[model samples]
Target: MAVAAAQELDELCYLSAQAMGSLTVSEHFHVIKLLGEGSYGKVMLAVHRKRGSPMALKFFPRESTTLASFLREYNLSLSYCTHPSLTRALGIFFSTPDYYVFAQQAGLYGDLYSVIVSEEGMEEERIQRVMAQLSGAVTHLHSLGFVHRDIKPENIFLCDSSCRWVKLGDFGLARAVGSTVRAVWYESPFCTPEVGPAKEAEKEWERRQEEGTEEEMEDTWITVEPGIDSWALGMLTYCLLTGCFPWEESTHDDRRYRKYEEWFEIERAHDKTDCYAIMEERYRENPPPSQFHGIGSLAMALFKELLNPEPKQRGSPEEILSYLGGPWLLGSEREQRRRAQEAQKEAQKVSETGGLKDELLREGKGER
Candidate 1:
């Protein structure tokens, strides 16, 4: 079994590199510290020896990276670097067995996931601004004929402690809009309702294998559509407001799945309640900062459009921006002042907290 497992591991795309502590790349940047690591690769905080500019250098292990995939990401980064809402990739360089992506350091408040989870939750105006940026970024990507298959809080980076600015990062899962590769390997709660592991199909495949009738897995061929990002944005909005995912898991077999089904359920029973109504009530009870004073109604209206079960009817990025107008979309002097105030508040909060077991907050500062 050990031998078989080792063989299976060897077949994976990632090639193991030597331990990376205190490593430097391209003879210019000196590694200061390790940021994070995952199945694909790890990120490091580095400084350019000559310019003294700090950067977050992402190292993708060559063993796991294909030439095509590498080029795809590199080109996409270059193409989207000009956008204010997308992280700027300075350049790409190859160092022995690994490829390095040098990008502008993102997030002073860390990723949205950490901020939302730590702060208990966010106010409505803040959420509207954040969502506007995110949805607008997605719209830009779609206009360029690419789909950001993975749109979640973790991929959304906050530029400062105030949460005024956000940039989308990590393009590894991105694909052309009409590409045949339509499946997500890992299930994310932020994914569209229809997007998830094809458990039933996988079980059938398992049965076929047991019966010695080999069949190709049809799971990867799930239809890809443009509304995927919009659906995910809706889920992200939900998390921002509630500090929790709408569903516990992205599978249909679970009871939590019924919560989503019940929302769009056509036949309403006596005991059933409209999900939108319940959400609106909850928002009123525990609301976020709102520019419009009574943003709950406006928010519910947008959520109704964004969270629509039908992909065709789901709100587009343009529609979202239209719904959240003035400072949220086009930006105004008032928006600038509000952000400055928020930033000041954030700094005060950090000082008050004084690093009391807040590793994530500390890390965010360190990363910046």
Candidate 2:
């Protein structure tokens, strides 16, 4: 009974979003429930009073922000994006005396973070499908010469529990390829540092990091790099498979990240078929500071490409497209495991038959 009601609610939300097209500010849409609220604004589940369609409406208070800030995200979601994996605005933007209201697609299953917490860890097959779409979404954005500066799980929406339909959200921070990105937030002693040009302000910050001191540094920024999205993609993939981030931060001072960096050097240079086996042996002796104990071989390979320490060496999101048909594809891990078990059985059977034949020949010779 409850499931049915939830399904009906989801359908209404989808229909409401569709019916909300060409809507005007004067028209009323009643708020059903508050989806979430942050400093930027509050998102509410709303329905058109006349058409009875659903949408998650974001309300930005007029006093808190300017028109430019609202329009930046609203215009990008509505006009620039046409891909299915990327979320879209519902073409509704208006302002009351106190607030600027924007409507967007309502996710039935909420954001990817919610699902990750509930499921603990997603299966590799499911991760493959969801990551494929996200990778495409990132590729599409890159093709437009824009980069999504933030690509965390919270910004990713799951249209369904199986994650067959997912969308990337929160493009407000996206910028042009060569734009200078000042820190998203001010850097403090407690905050992580950035790596800019060798002569840039961040060089001194790097020195501070190397010296194991957290003394305050001057303002710093870096030019947009190619692998920013790729690095986040690798982190997201690792999170989905393990239900935790590989490391809390990428700073060299971070112990967990340092361990991963050490292993990554070995994993990157050695291309032998027995490379994974070698890693397994070393892992047993001294495990890295990550929860990625059971990751499959091909998945690990993709992670290496995406998370290369040198940003320029990291592969693009589109590189994941080819992996869809390879071992990184859905069910590939289980399929490989099954094949290995089958081969072991076949070899055992052959050995047993050889022993039986030899025993029979010996008995016959003894009788003669």
Candidate 3:
């Protein structure tokens, strides 16, 4: 019996050593499943051989110019993205000359895009929370002098089953406040106007070249404005609340530009404008389904402010927080009614005082 026990202990130690063997990009991680695949590369759900920890391993093609850009952003995140809403690249390994892998926390529920576009859309309160978190993350990035040019549903990963926690990932398109590059880093219909030429859409780039205007000196660097990210955030908010883009999907650059230009012209003609330009015209021409309505006035107001056609007119991340904090200037129906009542009472008091209160005004004038 003693010999049998000794033999069992020896076997257990050998197994333990095997499990704890040296970890490497190729050897340490075993790919359990492919999480996602995209143009850049593929993401795999992997397990650390020795630690047995679940990790999301993202692989990138090395030969592409995008690899360096992605690595730069990942390195930046590792240094400064400590916020809960931002996903961090925990570890990295060069599996081969042609491939790079990064280990990060795996999202159980997948990305926000899949969730919203799927049959189970999110609720209004949940949308607010998601926006709040996204706002916080963007604000943090701005404070650090960086802008996440790509702010879309696909990049937002739900960290919990409740959909309350999320982490913004994919910084390949992100850039510093002062730095500029000609390449568009992300592909989504939610990009801002200023981000037009330099987006993931090859059609836009091709159009610029065809127009004989895209040529630049090797060292030319356009100063980037962080406001573009804010605009994208607005687009993101609209998508989260409505589960669809505000405008019809346009694949060609000319088509997208025409829609924007027409809306801008209409906006310049009118004194009052909502979140989008030519909204009435769009509705009249192509009315969305009934399910698109009822996103609430407060949300719409915020969306309009964020999606302001003119980049300068759009609110900064800080300003957006203020709006959200005040619940969008007495945004609720009851709050609006209360505000109107206060205004009426103030007007009545002014009438009673008969405009500037005679004696006090005279005394002030005499002193002057």
Local accuracy of candidate 3 as per-residue lDDT tens digits, 275-319: 333444454554333433444445544655666666777777655
Q: Give the alpha carbon lDDT tens digit for every residue of 64-116 in model 2.
A: 87766676677677765678999899887777777878889988688888877
- Give residue 210's error in model 3 in angstroms: 10
Q: Which 10 consecutive residues of model 3 have the lowest summed lDDT?
A: 325-334
lDDT of each: 0.63, 0.72, 0.64
| TM-scores of all candidate predictions against the true structure | 0.68, 0.73, 0.65
Give the lDDT ranking, best first: 2, 3, 1
Lowest lDDT 10-residue stretch of candidate 1:
12-21
Better of 2 and 3 by TM-score: 2
A best-first ranking of the candidates according to their TM-score comes to 2, 1, 3
* Native RMSD of candidate 2 (Å): 10.1
Candidate 1 residue 313 Cα shift, in angstroms, is 3.3
Instruction: Give, for candidate 2, the lowest lDDT window spanning 10 residues.
Output: 184-193
